[model samples]
Target: MGLKYKYESTSRRDTKELARNVRPGDRLYVIHDVSQVVAPLEDAQLYSEFIVTKDKAPFTGTPMVCSASAHRQVGGTSVTSLLVRYGEVYTERPVGIRNIAEEPPLLPEFQHLAARVAREHAADVAVARSEAASSGRRRWF
Candidate 1:
């Protein structure tokens, strides 16, 4: 079974409602445009196509505006009912479809963290080696 999707236009409140339903490990793929839609990558084998609107948007560098990044047990089958959890009126519709990455991009902060860790490890090893040489003991493990 391929991935299943439900398209809808969501406001900030609607987005929050959706986010609340997400569990700790469900993957939510969000496609953003003038309107936005979210697809939960859960139970694709029992998936059904939900057709609410037909539209398209420009394909830019990143198609995602938000992601739940976790699994959720939502309590509705229709877009209207799903978004209505937070009393939001469904007004937006799906614009277009695109592929989202399985892994998050390696942000600059993470890169910096990796570099710092490597540097610190190297420094610790150097200190250990110096202390060993200064003494009459030498061991390489």
Candidate 2:
């Protein structure tokens, strides 16, 4: 058994409704384009597919669009559904899919947090060393 879901087309409300109430034997691949295709009852597997296009403005240094990094839980013996959860911007360069290291810095005072962290870590090490010296050397049993 698996978790059932509600999916949607970013442009259409009717297709969104279709996704929410889809049956086990439903052909959901291109429901966004043609919203009324049903699956053959004889067929045990179901099919669904979705695409999320997020294009950013052009850049000079690095290519931004890294991964459409998606999972294909879709299979022949199983039902397939693709729900595109993206930035939803149509552009020449798709800006979707980013890693955690690519995240922008926090706002305002927290922007310099990395430097502060390094300083704090240095202070902690110094404090630990001083305490150890004062406590005297330990003799291993």
Instruction: Give the candidate number with the greatest TM-score.
Output: 2
> Model 1: clashing residue pairs?
9-92, 23-71, 23-72, 25-71, 26-70, 26-71
**What TM-score, to 2 decimals, does candidate 2 have?**
0.27
Residues 1-141, model 2: lDDT tens digits: 222233344546533444334433233232211233462222232222323222222332111122222353223221112334331222222223222223443557665897799899899878777777789964332
CA deviation > 4 Å runs, candidate 2:
1-79, 84-93, 96-101, 133-141
Best candidate according to lDDT? 1
Local distance difference test, per candidate? Answer: 0.39, 0.35
For model 1 the local lDDT of residue 72 reads 36
Model 1 misplaced regions, further than 4 Å? 1-105
